[model samples]
Target: MKKPRNKFFQKNKFDQAMTGYLFLLPALVALLVFLIGPIFYAFYISFFRFSFLEPQNAKFIGFSNYIHLFQDKEFLRALWNTSLYTIVVVPIQTAIALFLALIVNNIRGKTFFRVAYYLPTVTSTVAVSVMFTFIFQPDGILNKFLENFGIHGPNYFNSPTFALPAIMMMAIWSSVGQFMIIYLAGLQDIPEEVYEAAELDGARGFRLLWHVTLPLLKRTTFLNVVMSMIGTFQVFDQAYVISGGNGGPLNSTLTVVLDIFRKGFKTMQMGYASAMAFVLFAIILIFTLIQNYFLGREDK
Candidate 1:
Protein backbone atom coordinates (compact mmCIF):
# COMPACT_ATOMS: atom_id res chain seq x y z
CA MET A 1 0.00 0.00 0.00
CA LYS A 2 2.82 2.45 0.90
CA LYS A 3 4.79 1.71 -2.30
CA PRO A 4 1.70 2.20 -4.43
CA ARG A 5 0.97 5.57 -2.83
CA ASN A 6 4.59 6.72 -3.35
CA LYS A 7 4.42 5.79 -7.06
CA PHE A 8 1.16 7.66 -7.39
CA PHE A 9 2.73 10.84 -5.90
CA GLN A 10 5.73 10.57 -8.26
CA LYS A 11 3.43 10.25 -11.26
CA ASN A 12 1.38 13.29 -10.14
CA LYS A 13 4.57 15.40 -9.69
CA PHE A 14 5.75 14.44 -13.19
CA ASP A 15 2.38 15.42 -14.65
CA GLN A 16 2.50 18.79 -12.89
CA ALA A 17 5.98 19.47 -14.22
CA MET A 18 4.80 18.68 -17.76
CA THR A 19 1.84 21.01 -17.36
CA GLY A 20 4.10 23.86 -16.20
CA TYR A 21 6.37 23.33 -19.20
CA LEU A 22 3.40 23.34 -21.53
CA PHE A 23 2.24 26.66 -20.13
CA LEU A 24 5.70 28.20 -20.63
CA LEU A 25 6.22 26.74 -24.13
CA PRO A 26 4.71 29.66 -26.04
CA ALA A 27 6.89 32.32 -24.39
CA LEU A 28 9.97 30.17 -24.82
CA VAL A 29 9.17 29.64 -28.50
CA ALA A 30 8.65 33.36 -29.02
CA LEU A 31 12.00 34.22 -27.42
CA LEU A 32 13.77 31.64 -29.55
CA VAL A 33 12.19 32.96 -32.72
CA PHE A 34 12.51 36.67 -32.11
CA LEU A 35 15.66 36.98 -30.00
CA ILE A 36 17.90 33.94 -29.96
CA GLY A 37 17.32 33.02 -33.61
CA PRO A 38 18.06 36.49 -34.94
CA ILE A 39 21.24 36.74 -32.85
CA PHE A 40 22.56 33.47 -34.26
CA TYR A 41 21.55 34.41 -37.82
CA ALA A 42 23.32 37.76 -37.53
CA PHE A 43 26.44 36.04 -36.25
CA TYR A 44 26.39 33.62 -39.17
CA ILE A 45 25.83 36.37 -41.71
CA SER A 46 28.71 38.42 -40.36
CA PHE A 47 31.20 35.90 -41.68
CA PHE A 48 30.07 36.37 -45.27
CA ARG A 49 30.19 39.23 -47.75
CA PHE A 50 26.45 39.51 -47.63
CA SER A 51 24.19 42.16 -49.13
CA PHE A 52 20.44 42.47 -48.96
CA LEU A 53 20.34 43.58 -52.57
CA GLU A 54 22.14 40.43 -53.74
CA PRO A 55 21.38 37.97 -50.99
CA GLN A 56 21.94 34.95 -53.22
CA ASN A 57 25.40 36.11 -54.22
CA ALA A 58 26.92 36.16 -50.74
CA LYS A 59 30.44 34.80 -50.29
CA PHE A 60 32.10 33.68 -47.08
CA ILE A 61 34.63 36.42 -46.38
CA GLY A 62 35.91 35.27 -42.96
CA PHE A 63 37.15 38.27 -40.89
CA SER A 64 37.53 40.63 -43.83
CA ASN A 65 34.47 42.58 -42.70
CA TYR A 66 36.05 43.17 -39.30
CA ILE A 67 39.36 44.08 -40.93
CA HIS A 68 37.69 46.59 -43.18
CA LEU A 69 35.80 48.00 -40.18
CA PHE A 70 39.12 48.61 -38.38
CA GLN A 71 40.54 50.33 -41.47
CA ASP A 72 37.45 52.51 -42.08
CA LYS A 73 37.87 56.10 -40.94
CA GLU A 74 34.13 56.66 -40.71
CA PHE A 75 33.77 53.69 -38.35
CA LEU A 76 36.56 55.09 -36.17
CA ARG A 77 34.89 58.49 -36.11
CA ALA A 78 31.58 56.93 -35.19
CA LEU A 79 33.25 55.04 -32.34
CA TRP A 80 34.83 58.22 -31.00
CA ASN A 81 31.55 60.11 -31.25
CA THR A 82 29.62 57.30 -29.54
CA SER A 83 32.19 57.05 -26.72
CA LEU A 84 32.15 60.78 -26.09
CA TYR A 85 28.37 60.93 -26.18
CA THR A 86 28.06 58.04 -23.74
CA ILE A 87 30.58 59.58 -21.31
CA VAL A 88 28.99 63.00 -21.35
CA VAL A 89 25.32 62.08 -21.46
CA VAL A 90 25.38 59.23 -18.93
CA PRO A 91 26.89 61.29 -16.07
CA ILE A 92 24.83 64.38 -16.78
CA GLN A 93 21.58 62.48 -17.07
CA THR A 94 22.26 60.39 -13.99
CA ALA A 95 23.21 63.43 -11.92
CA ILE A 96 20.13 65.37 -13.00
CA ALA A 97 17.87 62.39 -12.41
CA LEU A 98 19.33 61.79 -8.95
CA PHE A 99 18.94 65.46 -8.05
CA LEU A 100 15.33 65.52 -9.25
CA ALA A 101 14.55 62.29 -7.44
CA LEU A 102 16.02 63.61 -4.18
CA ILE A 103 14.01 66.83 -4.40
CA VAL A 104 10.73 65.28 -5.52
CA ASN A 105 10.80 62.43 -3.05
CA ASN A 106 11.03 64.79 -0.06
CA ILE A 107 8.25 67.12 -1.19
CA ARG A 108 4.55 67.29 -0.18
CA GLY A 109 3.10 67.09 -3.70
CA LYS A 110 5.54 64.35 -4.63
CA THR A 111 3.12 62.42 -6.77
CA PHE A 112 2.22 65.39 -8.94
CA PHE A 113 5.83 66.40 -9.43
CA ARG A 114 6.81 62.81 -10.14
CA VAL A 115 4.18 62.54 -12.86
CA ALA A 116 5.09 65.92 -14.30
CA TYR A 117 8.78 65.10 -14.49
CA TYR A 118 8.12 61.67 -15.94
CA LEU A 119 5.80 62.93 -18.67
CA PRO A 120 8.66 63.13 -21.14
CA THR A 121 9.42 59.42 -20.70
CA VAL A 122 5.84 58.51 -21.58
CA THR A 123 5.75 60.76 -24.64
CA SER A 124 6.75 59.40 -28.05
CA THR A 125 10.48 59.66 -28.81
CA VAL A 126 9.92 60.98 -32.32
CA ALA A 127 7.66 63.70 -31.00
CA VAL A 128 10.23 64.65 -28.37
CA SER A 129 12.99 64.69 -31.00
CA VAL A 130 10.91 66.91 -33.26
CA MET A 131 10.11 69.22 -30.37
CA PHE A 132 13.79 69.55 -29.45
CA THR A 133 14.77 70.14 -33.06
CA PHE A 134 12.53 73.18 -33.12
CA ILE A 135 13.78 74.35 -29.73
CA PHE A 136 17.37 74.23 -30.93
CA GLN A 137 16.66 75.92 -34.23
CA PRO A 138 18.59 79.19 -34.75
CA ASP A 139 15.40 81.25 -34.57
CA GLY A 140 13.65 79.09 -31.99
CA ILE A 141 12.63 79.65 -28.37
CA LEU A 142 16.09 78.78 -27.03
CA ASN A 143 17.87 81.37 -29.12
CA LYS A 144 15.19 83.94 -28.36
CA PHE A 145 15.60 83.31 -24.62
CA LEU A 146 19.37 83.56 -24.98
CA GLU A 147 19.03 86.75 -26.94
CA ASN A 148 16.95 88.19 -24.10
CA PHE A 149 19.97 87.49 -21.89
CA GLY A 150 22.21 89.38 -24.31
CA ILE A 151 23.60 86.11 -25.68
CA HIS A 152 23.36 84.67 -29.21
CA GLY A 153 22.92 80.96 -29.68
CA PRO A 154 24.63 79.13 -32.51
CA ASN A 155 22.83 77.19 -35.26
CA TYR A 156 22.65 74.05 -33.15
CA PHE A 157 21.90 71.35 -35.71
CA ASN A 158 23.70 72.97 -38.63
CA SER A 159 27.03 73.55 -36.93
CA PRO A 160 29.29 70.49 -36.68
CA THR A 161 30.89 71.88 -33.53
CA PHE A 162 27.63 72.34 -31.65
CA ALA A 163 25.37 69.70 -33.29
CA LEU A 164 26.53 66.68 -31.24
CA PRO A 165 26.50 68.59 -27.94
CA ALA A 166 22.99 69.89 -28.72
CA ILE A 167 21.81 66.35 -29.40
CA MET A 168 23.45 65.14 -26.17
CA MET A 169 21.60 67.83 -24.22
CA MET A 170 18.33 66.73 -25.78
CA ALA A 171 19.07 63.11 -24.99
CA ILE A 172 19.76 64.00 -21.37
CA TRP A 173 16.50 65.95 -21.11
CA SER A 174 14.44 63.18 -22.67
CA SER A 175 16.01 60.38 -20.61
CA VAL A 176 16.42 61.89 -17.12
CA GLY A 177 12.71 61.64 -16.32
CA GLN A 178 12.63 57.85 -16.51
CA PHE A 179 15.78 57.54 -14.43
CA MET A 180 14.38 59.98 -11.92
CA ILE A 181 11.47 57.63 -11.42
CA ILE A 182 13.92 54.78 -10.84
CA TYR A 183 15.88 56.81 -8.31
CA LEU A 184 12.69 57.88 -6.60
CA ALA A 185 11.72 54.27 -6.17
CA GLY A 186 15.13 53.53 -4.74
CA LEU A 187 14.93 56.52 -2.41
CA GLN A 188 11.60 55.34 -1.05
CA ASP A 189 13.02 51.92 -0.29
CA ILE A 190 15.64 53.40 2.07
CA PRO A 191 14.59 53.31 5.71
CA GLU A 192 13.61 56.66 7.22
CA GLU A 193 15.08 55.54 10.55
CA VAL A 194 18.54 55.89 9.06
CA TYR A 195 17.93 59.55 8.32
CA GLU A 196 16.32 60.05 11.72
CA ALA A 197 19.39 58.63 13.45
CA ALA A 198 21.64 60.82 11.36
CA GLU A 199 19.59 63.85 12.39
CA LEU A 200 19.94 62.90 16.07
CA ASP A 201 23.71 62.89 15.52
CA GLY A 202 23.41 66.58 14.43
CA ALA A 203 23.73 65.76 10.77
CA ARG A 204 21.44 67.93 8.65
CA GLY A 205 20.60 68.66 5.04
CA PHE A 206 23.55 68.09 2.67
CA ARG A 207 25.57 66.30 5.31
CA LEU A 208 22.79 63.79 6.00
CA LEU A 209 22.17 63.35 2.31
CA TRP A 210 25.83 62.73 1.57
CA HIS A 211 26.51 60.26 4.43
CA VAL A 212 23.12 58.56 4.65
CA THR A 213 21.13 58.95 1.45
CA LEU A 214 23.80 58.68 -1.19
CA PRO A 215 25.51 55.71 0.43
CA LEU A 216 22.24 53.82 0.75
CA LEU A 217 21.34 54.65 -2.84
CA LYS A 218 24.53 53.20 -4.31
CA ARG A 219 22.76 50.22 -5.88
CA THR A 220 20.26 52.48 -7.58
CA THR A 221 23.04 54.77 -8.75
CA PHE A 222 24.87 51.77 -10.23
CA LEU A 223 21.76 50.68 -12.09
CA ASN A 224 21.04 54.20 -13.38
CA VAL A 225 24.64 54.65 -14.51
CA VAL A 226 24.74 51.33 -16.37
CA MET A 227 21.36 51.88 -18.03
CA SER A 228 22.19 55.45 -19.05
CA MET A 229 25.53 54.33 -20.43
CA ILE A 230 23.94 51.59 -22.51
CA GLY A 231 21.15 53.87 -23.78
CA THR A 232 23.53 56.68 -24.73
CA PHE A 233 25.81 54.26 -26.55
CA GLN A 234 22.93 53.20 -28.78
CA VAL A 235 21.49 56.70 -29.35
CA PHE A 236 20.22 57.07 -32.90
CA ASP A 237 16.81 58.68 -33.16
CA GLN A 238 17.77 62.15 -31.83
CA ALA A 239 20.81 62.25 -34.05
CA TYR A 240 18.97 60.78 -37.01
CA VAL A 241 16.04 63.17 -36.73
CA ILE A 242 18.09 66.25 -35.89
CA SER A 243 20.77 65.54 -38.47
CA GLY A 244 18.08 64.78 -41.07
CA GLY A 245 19.03 61.04 -41.16
CA ASN A 246 22.41 61.73 -42.72
CA GLY A 247 24.31 62.04 -39.39
CA GLY A 248 25.26 65.28 -40.95
CA PRO A 249 27.26 68.50 -40.44
CA LEU A 250 30.37 66.37 -41.10
CA ASN A 251 29.09 63.22 -39.36
CA SER A 252 29.37 64.89 -36.00
CA THR A 253 26.32 63.09 -34.63
CA LEU A 254 26.96 59.72 -36.23
CA THR A 255 26.68 57.08 -33.54
CA VAL A 256 27.88 53.51 -34.01
CA VAL A 257 24.31 52.22 -34.16
CA LEU A 258 23.37 54.88 -36.73
CA ASP A 259 26.40 53.95 -38.80
CA ILE A 260 25.42 50.30 -38.65
CA PHE A 261 21.88 51.17 -39.71
CA ARG A 262 23.13 53.28 -42.61
CA LYS A 263 25.53 50.56 -43.75
CA GLY A 264 22.98 47.76 -43.49
CA PHE A 265 19.76 49.31 -44.77
CA LYS A 266 20.95 52.36 -46.67
CA THR A 267 24.10 51.03 -48.35
CA MET A 268 23.24 47.29 -48.28
CA GLN A 269 26.55 46.20 -46.78
CA MET A 270 24.89 43.52 -44.69
CA GLY A 271 28.06 41.72 -43.65
CA TYR A 272 29.90 44.88 -42.78
CA ALA A 273 26.92 46.15 -40.90
CA SER A 274 26.64 42.88 -39.02
CA ALA A 275 30.27 43.26 -37.97
CA MET A 276 29.61 46.79 -36.80
CA ALA A 277 26.54 45.68 -34.84
CA PHE A 278 28.52 42.90 -33.19
CA VAL A 279 31.27 45.35 -32.24
CA LEU A 280 28.73 47.67 -30.68
CA PHE A 281 27.25 44.71 -28.83
CA ALA A 282 30.71 43.81 -27.57
CA ILE A 283 31.28 47.36 -26.37
CA ILE A 284 28.00 47.45 -24.45
CA LEU A 285 28.72 44.06 -22.98
CA ILE A 286 32.19 45.11 -21.83
CA PHE A 287 30.99 48.30 -20.19
CA THR A 288 28.06 46.57 -18.54
CA LEU A 289 30.36 43.91 -17.12
CA ILE A 290 32.78 46.54 -15.87
CA GLN A 291 29.97 48.48 -14.22
CA ASN A 292 28.53 45.40 -12.59
CA TYR A 293 31.91 44.24 -11.35
CA PHE A 294 33.03 47.50 -9.80
CA LEU A 295 29.63 48.52 -8.50
CA GLY A 296 28.83 45.10 -7.14
CA ARG A 297 32.21 44.88 -5.48
CA GLU A 298 31.75 48.30 -3.91
CA ASP A 299 28.34 47.30 -2.61
CA LYS A 300 29.89 44.30 -0.90
Candidate 2:
Protein backbone atom coordinates (compact mmCIF):
# COMPACT_ATOMS: atom_id res chain seq x y z
CA MET A 1 0.00 0.00 0.00
CA LYS A 2 2.86 2.41 0.87
CA LYS A 3 4.68 1.68 -2.39
CA PRO A 4 1.49 2.30 -4.49
CA ARG A 5 0.89 5.61 -2.65
CA ASN A 6 4.50 6.70 -3.41
CA LYS A 7 4.04 5.85 -7.09
CA PHE A 8 0.76 7.82 -7.15
CA PHE A 9 2.53 10.92 -5.68
CA GLN A 10 5.31 10.69 -8.23
CA LYS A 11 2.78 10.45 -11.07
CA ASN A 12 0.89 13.47 -9.69
CA LYS A 13 4.05 15.63 -9.60
CA PHE A 14 5.00 14.61 -13.11
CA ASP A 15 1.54 15.48 -14.40
CA GLN A 16 1.66 18.88 -12.70
CA ALA A 17 5.07 19.62 -14.18
CA MET A 18 3.82 18.72 -17.63
CA THR A 19 0.80 21.00 -17.20
CA GLY A 20 3.03 23.93 -16.17
CA TYR A 21 5.27 23.45 -19.21
CA LEU A 22 2.21 23.19 -21.46
CA PHE A 23 1.00 26.54 -20.21
CA LEU A 24 4.41 28.12 -20.89
CA LEU A 25 4.67 26.66 -24.39
CA PRO A 26 2.79 29.45 -26.20
CA ALA A 27 4.85 32.26 -24.69
CA LEU A 28 8.06 30.32 -25.45
CA VAL A 29 6.99 29.83 -29.04
CA ALA A 30 6.09 33.51 -29.40
CA LEU A 31 9.49 34.58 -28.09
CA LEU A 32 11.28 32.27 -30.48
CA VAL A 33 9.19 33.35 -33.48
CA PHE A 34 9.06 37.09 -32.83
CA LEU A 35 12.24 37.90 -30.95
CA ILE A 36 14.92 35.20 -31.01
CA GLY A 37 14.31 34.16 -34.59
CA PRO A 38 14.79 37.62 -36.05
CA ILE A 39 17.90 38.19 -33.93
CA PHE A 40 19.71 35.13 -35.33
CA TYR A 41 18.38 35.82 -38.83
CA ALA A 42 19.74 39.36 -38.72
CA PHE A 43 23.14 38.11 -37.61
CA TYR A 44 23.15 35.59 -40.41
CA ILE A 45 22.13 38.20 -43.00
CA SER A 46 24.77 40.68 -41.78
CA PHE A 47 27.55 38.77 -43.55
CA PHE A 48 25.89 39.18 -46.95
CA ARG A 49 25.84 42.17 -49.32
CA PHE A 50 22.46 42.88 -50.91
CA SER A 51 19.33 44.97 -50.68
CA PHE A 52 16.60 43.24 -48.69
CA LEU A 53 14.38 43.46 -51.75
CA GLU A 54 16.67 41.12 -53.67
CA PRO A 55 17.56 38.48 -51.10
CA GLN A 56 18.28 35.89 -53.80
CA ASN A 57 21.26 37.96 -54.97
CA ALA A 58 22.80 38.34 -51.52
CA LYS A 59 26.58 37.81 -51.86
CA PHE A 60 28.51 36.50 -48.85
CA ILE A 61 30.99 39.27 -48.08
CA GLY A 62 32.09 38.00 -44.65
CA PHE A 63 33.22 40.97 -42.45
CA SER A 64 33.43 43.50 -45.30
CA ASN A 65 30.14 45.19 -44.39
CA TYR A 66 31.27 45.68 -40.78
CA ILE A 67 34.66 46.92 -42.01
CA HIS A 68 33.00 49.51 -44.22
CA LEU A 69 30.84 50.63 -41.27
CA PHE A 70 33.97 52.04 -39.55
CA GLN A 71 34.94 53.77 -42.79
CA ASP A 72 31.47 55.38 -43.13
CA LYS A 73 31.65 58.95 -41.88
CA GLU A 74 27.89 59.30 -41.38
CA PHE A 75 27.81 56.13 -39.26
CA LEU A 76 30.64 57.49 -37.15
CA ARG A 77 28.74 60.79 -36.69
CA ALA A 78 25.71 58.83 -35.55
CA LEU A 79 27.81 56.91 -33.02
CA TRP A 80 29.29 60.15 -31.67
CA ASN A 81 25.85 61.73 -31.35
CA THR A 82 24.48 58.62 -29.61
CA SER A 83 27.41 58.40 -27.20
CA LEU A 84 27.10 62.11 -26.38
CA TYR A 85 23.37 61.78 -25.77
CA THR A 86 23.86 58.78 -23.46
CA ILE A 87 26.66 60.44 -21.45
CA VAL A 88 24.75 63.71 -20.95
CA VAL A 89 21.18 62.48 -20.60
CA VAL A 90 21.62 59.43 -18.36
CA PRO A 91 23.24 61.06 -15.30
CA ILE A 92 21.17 64.24 -15.35
CA GLN A 93 17.90 62.38 -15.75
CA THR A 94 18.76 59.87 -13.01
CA ALA A 95 19.72 62.62 -10.57
CA ILE A 96 16.59 64.64 -11.26
CA ALA A 97 14.40 61.56 -10.91
CA LEU A 98 15.97 60.63 -7.58
CA PHE A 99 15.50 64.20 -6.31
CA LEU A 100 11.85 64.24 -7.38
CA ALA A 101 11.23 60.83 -5.81
CA LEU A 102 12.72 61.99 -2.49
CA ILE A 103 10.61 65.14 -2.50
CA VAL A 104 7.32 63.53 -3.44
CA ASN A 105 7.61 60.55 -1.11
CA ASN A 106 7.60 62.75 2.01
CA ILE A 107 5.17 65.45 0.90
CA ARG A 108 1.43 65.72 1.25
CA GLY A 109 -0.58 64.98 -1.89
CA LYS A 110 2.03 62.46 -2.97
CA THR A 111 -0.53 60.79 -5.17
CA PHE A 112 -1.21 64.02 -7.00
CA PHE A 113 2.48 64.75 -7.46
CA ARG A 114 3.18 61.24 -8.79
CA VAL A 115 0.29 61.43 -11.24
CA ALA A 116 1.25 64.91 -12.47
CA TYR A 117 4.90 64.03 -13.01
CA TYR A 118 4.22 60.64 -14.60
CA LEU A 119 1.83 62.11 -17.17
CA PRO A 120 4.65 62.65 -19.63
CA THR A 121 5.67 58.99 -19.48
CA VAL A 122 2.20 57.95 -20.56
CA THR A 123 2.03 60.65 -23.25
CA SER A 124 2.87 59.78 -26.87
CA THR A 125 6.49 60.41 -27.88
CA VAL A 126 5.71 61.82 -31.32
CA ALA A 127 3.19 64.21 -29.80
CA VAL A 128 5.74 65.42 -27.29
CA SER A 129 8.31 65.93 -30.06
CA VAL A 130 5.85 67.93 -32.17
CA MET A 131 4.82 70.04 -29.16
CA PHE A 132 8.41 70.81 -28.26
CA THR A 133 9.26 71.65 -31.87
CA PHE A 134 6.72 74.45 -31.80
CA ILE A 135 7.90 75.61 -28.37
CA PHE A 136 11.53 75.81 -29.57
CA GLN A 137 10.78 77.78 -32.72
CA PRO A 138 12.53 81.18 -32.87
CA ASP A 139 9.37 83.19 -32.09
CA GLY A 140 7.70 80.52 -29.97
CA ILE A 141 7.00 80.36 -26.23
CA LEU A 142 10.56 79.44 -25.21
CA ASN A 143 12.09 82.23 -27.31
CA LYS A 144 9.45 84.63 -26.04
CA PHE A 145 10.36 83.76 -22.46
CA LEU A 146 14.02 84.31 -23.26
CA GLU A 147 13.18 87.61 -24.99
CA ASN A 148 11.80 88.97 -21.72
CA PHE A 149 15.32 88.44 -20.33
CA GLY A 150 16.76 90.28 -23.39
CA ILE A 151 18.19 87.16 -25.01
CA HIS A 152 17.25 86.04 -28.48
CA GLY A 153 16.72 82.29 -28.95
CA PRO A 154 17.90 80.43 -32.03
CA ASN A 155 15.60 78.12 -34.01
CA TYR A 156 16.35 75.11 -31.89
CA PHE A 157 15.44 72.17 -34.11
CA ASN A 158 16.92 73.80 -37.20
CA SER A 159 20.25 74.65 -35.59
CA PRO A 160 22.88 71.90 -35.38
CA THR A 161 24.39 73.46 -32.26
CA PHE A 162 21.13 73.69 -30.30
CA ALA A 163 19.17 70.82 -31.83
CA LEU A 164 20.68 67.98 -29.81
CA PRO A 165 20.66 70.03 -26.62
CA ALA A 166 16.99 70.86 -27.15
CA ILE A 167 16.25 67.18 -27.67
CA MET A 168 18.22 66.31 -24.54
CA MET A 169 16.15 68.76 -22.49
CA MET A 170 12.94 67.24 -23.78
CA ALA A 171 14.28 63.72 -23.25
CA ILE A 172 15.10 64.55 -19.64
CA TRP A 173 11.66 65.99 -19.04
CA SER A 174 9.87 62.98 -20.51
CA SER A 175 12.12 60.18 -19.20
CA VAL A 176 12.67 61.46 -15.66
CA GLY A 177 9.07 60.87 -14.61
CA GLN A 178 9.28 57.11 -15.25
CA PHE A 179 12.51 56.79 -13.31
CA MET A 180 10.96 58.93 -10.56
CA ILE A 181 8.25 56.30 -10.24
CA ILE A 182 10.90 53.57 -10.05
CA TYR A 183 12.64 55.48 -7.29
CA LEU A 184 9.31 56.00 -5.57
CA ALA A 185 8.70 52.26 -5.52
CA GLY A 186 12.16 51.72 -4.08
CA LEU A 187 11.57 54.40 -1.44
CA GLN A 188 8.29 52.86 -0.34
CA ASP A 189 9.98 49.49 0.02
CA ILE A 190 12.31 50.83 2.73
CA PRO A 191 11.02 50.12 6.26
CA GLU A 192 10.36 52.89 8.81
CA GLU A 193 12.41 50.92 11.35
CA VAL A 194 15.51 51.48 9.26
CA TYR A 195 15.05 55.24 9.58
CA GLU A 196 14.43 54.95 13.33
CA ALA A 197 17.60 52.92 13.81
CA ALA A 198 19.49 55.41 11.63
CA GLU A 199 18.30 58.42 13.65
CA LEU A 200 19.12 56.76 17.03
CA ASP A 201 22.75 56.55 15.92
CA GLY A 202 23.05 60.40 15.93
CA ALA A 203 22.56 60.67 12.16
CA ARG A 204 20.83 63.92 11.31
CA GLY A 205 18.71 64.65 8.23
CA PHE A 206 21.32 64.90 5.49
CA ARG A 207 23.62 62.39 7.15
CA LEU A 208 20.78 59.93 7.57
CA LEU A 209 19.93 60.35 3.92
CA TRP A 210 23.53 59.99 2.87
CA HIS A 211 24.32 56.95 5.01
CA VAL A 212 21.00 55.13 5.40
CA THR A 213 18.81 56.13 2.48
CA LEU A 214 21.36 56.28 -0.30
CA PRO A 215 23.14 53.10 0.77
CA LEU A 216 19.93 51.13 0.98
CA LEU A 217 18.79 52.41 -2.42
CA LYS A 218 21.90 51.28 -4.27
CA ARG A 219 20.02 48.53 -6.12
CA THR A 220 17.43 51.01 -7.33
CA THR A 221 20.16 53.43 -8.41
CA PHE A 222 21.92 50.71 -10.40
CA LEU A 223 18.66 49.77 -12.11
CA ASN A 224 17.82 53.38 -12.98
CA VAL A 225 21.30 54.04 -14.37
CA VAL A 226 21.32 50.91 -16.54
CA MET A 227 17.83 51.41 -17.94
CA SER A 228 18.42 55.13 -18.54
CA MET A 229 21.66 54.37 -20.38
CA ILE A 230 19.97 51.76 -22.57
CA GLY A 231 17.06 54.10 -23.37
CA THR A 232 19.41 56.87 -24.44
CA PHE A 233 21.33 54.47 -26.70
CA GLN A 234 18.15 53.38 -28.48
CA VAL A 235 16.66 56.87 -28.77
CA PHE A 236 15.27 56.94 -32.26
CA ASP A 237 11.64 58.08 -32.33
CA GLN A 238 12.22 61.50 -30.80
CA ALA A 239 15.35 62.08 -32.86
CA TYR A 240 13.54 60.85 -35.93
CA VAL A 241 10.48 62.99 -35.27
CA ILE A 242 12.30 66.11 -34.11
CA SER A 243 14.88 65.95 -36.92
CA GLY A 244 12.16 65.28 -39.50
CA GLY A 245 13.15 61.60 -40.08
CA ASN A 246 16.36 62.65 -41.82
CA GLY A 247 18.40 63.09 -38.63
CA GLY A 248 19.07 66.57 -39.90
CA PRO A 249 20.53 69.74 -38.38
CA LEU A 250 24.02 68.39 -39.19
CA ASN A 251 23.18 64.90 -37.84
CA SER A 252 23.53 66.11 -34.27
CA THR A 253 20.48 64.07 -33.30
CA LEU A 254 21.31 61.11 -35.52
CA THR A 255 21.42 58.33 -32.97
CA VAL A 256 22.83 54.88 -33.81
CA VAL A 257 19.34 53.39 -33.96
CA LEU A 258 18.17 56.18 -36.24
CA ASP A 259 21.08 55.59 -38.58
CA ILE A 260 20.35 51.86 -38.62
CA PHE A 261 16.74 52.54 -39.56
CA ARG A 262 17.79 54.87 -42.36
CA LYS A 263 20.28 52.39 -43.72
CA GLY A 264 17.88 49.45 -43.52
CA PHE A 265 14.71 51.07 -44.79
CA LYS A 266 15.53 54.28 -46.62
CA THR A 267 18.69 53.14 -48.39
CA MET A 268 17.73 49.43 -48.55
CA GLN A 269 21.19 48.41 -47.37
CA MET A 270 19.78 45.75 -45.06
CA GLY A 271 23.05 43.82 -44.77
CA TYR A 272 25.02 46.87 -43.65
CA ALA A 273 22.16 47.89 -41.38
CA SER A 274 22.13 44.45 -39.77
CA ALA A 275 25.87 44.77 -39.16
CA MET A 276 25.35 48.12 -37.46
CA ALA A 277 22.53 46.69 -35.36
CA PHE A 278 24.72 43.78 -34.17
CA VAL A 279 27.60 46.14 -33.37
CA LEU A 280 25.23 48.26 -31.30
CA PHE A 281 23.97 45.15 -29.52
CA ALA A 282 27.55 44.20 -28.66
CA ILE A 283 28.28 47.72 -27.37
CA ILE A 284 25.22 47.69 -25.13
CA LEU A 285 26.13 44.21 -23.93
CA ILE A 286 29.65 45.32 -23.04
CA PHE A 287 28.41 48.31 -21.09
CA THR A 288 25.92 46.15 -19.23
CA LEU A 289 28.58 43.61 -18.34
CA ILE A 290 30.96 46.33 -17.09
CA GLN A 291 28.16 47.86 -15.01
CA ASN A 292 27.29 44.47 -13.57
CA TYR A 293 30.91 43.91 -12.60
CA PHE A 294 31.15 47.27 -10.80
CA LEU A 295 27.65 47.89 -9.43
CA GLY A 296 26.83 44.29 -8.58
CA ARG A 297 30.22 43.37 -7.22
CA GLU A 298 28.91 42.88 -3.71
CA ASP A 299 25.80 40.97 -4.63
CA LYS A 300 25.72 37.37 -3.40
Tens-digit lDDT string for candidate 1 (208-250): 8899999988889989998888898888888888887788899
TM-score of each: 0.96, 0.96
Show the lowest summed lDDT stretch of 10 residues, model 1: 291-300
Global lDDT for candidate 2?
Answer: 0.93
Candidate 2 residue-wise lDDT, 259-283, digit = tens: 9999999999999999999999989
Q: List the residue pairs that clash in candidate 2.
A: none
lDDT of each prediction vs. the true structure?
0.91, 0.93
TM-score of 2: 0.96
Residue 127 error, candidate 2, Å? 0.8
